[model samples]
Target: MFDSFVFMAPPLPDDLVTRYFRHCLEDSLFTLRRQVRMARMSGRFGANDETRLSLMPMILQSLLEDGIRDRLPLQRVDPEWSPETLVIAMHLYSVEARRIQSPEETRRIQQTFPDIKTPDFTSAEHTGQLREAYIAARLAALRDGTTPTSLSIGIEL
Candidate 1:
């Protein structure tokens, strides 16, 4: 599910970052869950953790800038809102959302939302939309000053 496309030559760091961002943005909830689980199971973030860490902030910043250029409502309307902050918030939110959950908590969540069908991550098309909604809710909370940080992970965004 996380296959990289071939290119003419060695892809630039920026190219890799762009691809990663796009992959995250386009991933299904199930895919995200699987990815998060696999990462945790590996017991290390990645062999290239240092490289990824260095590139992620820049990638996120660029993605946010692109969003701004496209006139997407990525940031709160409040004048005090910072695009950089919003980018970080969005990145963290996405990461945590897909983080592995305890079996007990997963069962509890399943019980709590019995009516909502579990999303199929393999082929679902609206995961990006769902993720964007999560981001939007975080932005709304900030805009309203209802929450100090954006959101708590397990609340069913």
Candidate 2:
């Protein structure tokens, strides 16, 4: 006899949070890697909002840190590089890493650096416009290179 269906709770692992972060990071880094590499994408940046520019340095620092654990990021990036420059370089490095690691690499990398997904960047895209406005914010700093911007790495890279 058919009766009201009994609800079954979905399995939630003890490491669910870790697993979620891993999933998110893989998805995020994938798109960020592509967006950073798209040629002439620099033009997409507006001429103000130095606040967003801070992301450039942050991105560079992250990639450099990653390179510390793996030689790829270091080998591909120049220490004398700017944050904007680092974007492209990191994108290249990420792509290369993806290639070398096969499909299983993302999972493995998460195991090694469980916190990689913790980047504090807000969302960058919304309904149809730049969601976080990070690109616009970093624009001024990227162009002048000597502006009183907050995230400027004066020493280069």
Candidate 3:
């Protein structure tokens, strides 16, 4: 069932993709803030979450409007892609864009979250890896009878 959706979905328009990216960025920040607030209530808010909270605004600011339209590779939002896939791709692109637009902020983020991976949009290999990872995650989510949430994208606070 999910495989059929993956195989038959049409490519999303460039404008729609850009809109999705913007929505994802806003949604991610809102979700993170709520999580951080809850964690604070529980005395579970930690250094890593603090670091992410601080850096997320910078990254989000850099990727707004023209920044997103200019940085995003529309081609990578494949015809087989779901909204979840676009969320993952946009998240990766956001990281790469931040790295290019604000190296210092990117460095701060990397220092805090050493395991977070960003793709080199110029490299086919890197983009291919991203595509493969998205497919695997989507398939796994389907098999588990769950939908992938945009918040699961690694950069979430």
Candidate 4:
């Protein structure tokens, strides 16, 4: 069942895909939701890797198109906002999401990449709250005249 949902990228409308990303972020199932997010951004999957392509990248790409058409909030906050910035944010969120959802896998990942910093999601009660905090922090930094780096919204929250 989980495999079906993760592997099949239906021909969902752009709006629906965007909505699905939000739902996935809020989903309680760690194995599916967090894994999909992490896998999508892990850079191991090529553009043609449909079996590995999860919903996060699809929706994020769609969001970038929408942002180009209708100016995303990050754009208003910082005129230099690009899709790469959003992708980086997604990657950070995925790292934290995987940590919160799958501790064992996260530990293995940490051991694999010793220098990589992972967020402390041990106490988080909701993934959405953490995502909101990240976005809020980025926006705050941008509004304060600080050039919001890809990691300006660190995993502090």
Candidate 5:
């Protein structure tokens, strides 16, 4: 039933969409940076850590912000992409950078860096699910003429 439910809601205004996406992107970047830092401090940082850390800000400022402002679909910005794809990409990159080999390692990392959250879903199927949930929540908020306090982008496994 949940999978079949669909709301025929109008698109949010460009300005509002841009602002919302910008906020989400900023928060994601901040969290990623914090995770990178924590990993470095814990001596679990990956070999390519410096490159990923350096490139993230550039991606945010150049690619993400521009795409958000233009109201471009993720595919238009980059093929086979979505907002959730970006989130998943960042999470996976962080995981790789931290050299997390298994669930056990992830748990240990979380234990050490309580603030860092490894997403439960990184598979393509989960990415689509997350994207759907995010859009649904955003559309509901727009329909009600209120900004959502938080977007539902990461459903727990």
Candidate 6:
């Protein structure tokens, strides 16, 4: 259910961002329980640990800004909200980028993902897996021919 794309994010570093992604993937309880386990084991839970990080930005943005909540499951999938995840959310918004408030926003996305290839992304599927589905569908939607059915309301203008 994680990193199901051809260009899946490369191995992350030893930082909290990477560790938290690992931790959140283990459990469906929003955050991983093992982090606290390892924290207690290692001592101090290590503020330096990314597992103690926050995804509040994605959560709020997904809810307030994007209005695409079938989006990601913070509790079920993972909640590291790493730059990669943030980018995913941005691209997901790209799926319907045309519908948001500004042309500037749409142009920004073009700038953000200039290399967003088509055929590679257009076929992304859900595989009946939530996380996998989220990633695939979002990527697919970013393809050149992809204009979410909702596009009529925005860029088609």
Select the stronger candidate by TM-score from 1 and 4: 1
For residues 50-127, write the lDDT of model 4, one tens digit per residue: 422332333334333332122223432333436655554455445544443366643442333222234432322223
Cα deviation of 6 in candidate 5 (Å)? Answer: 8.3
Top of the candidates by lDDT: 3
Model 4 sits at a Cα RMSD from the real structure of 17.1
CA displacement after TM-score superposition, residue 18 of candidate 4 (Å): 27
Best by TM-score: 5
Alpha-carbon runs more than 4 Å astray in model 3:
1-12, 55-157
The residue ranges of model 5 lying beyond 4 angstroms of the native Cα positions read 1-8, 48-157
Estimate, for each residue in 1-157, the C-alpha lDDT of model 2 and write its tens digit: 2222221322223364344444544555444444443422566545332434444555434433443223344444568867876665556455543443454643343343343343421221110011112222222223344243344323544
Model 4 misses residue 55 by how many Å?
A: 25
Off by over 4 Å in 6: 1-26, 50-52, 56-123, 127-129, 132-157
lDDT of 3 by residue, 2-63 (tens): 65655453343345334433443444445544565578779987765554444333333434
46-135: candidate 6 lDDT, tens digit per residue: 433432133333343453434444444444235555666565554544454334334564333223332333332332231112222222
lDDT of each: 0.37, 0.39, 0.43, 0.37, 0.40, 0.36
Model 1, 54-104: lDDT tens digits are 433433343333432232234433355366554554555354344313345
Runs in model 2 deviating more than 4 A are 1-14, 39-42, 46-157
TM-score of 4: 0.19
Candidate 3: residue 15 lDDT (0-100): 52
Q: Mind giving the per-residue lDDT tens digits that candidate 5 earns over 25-141? A: 454445544565578669988645644444344333333223223222343234444565555445544444333234564444233322223353234333233333333332332
Q: In model 1, which regions exceed 4 Å deviation?
A: 1-115, 119-124, 146-157
- lDDT of candidate 3 at residue 48, scale 0 to 100: 52
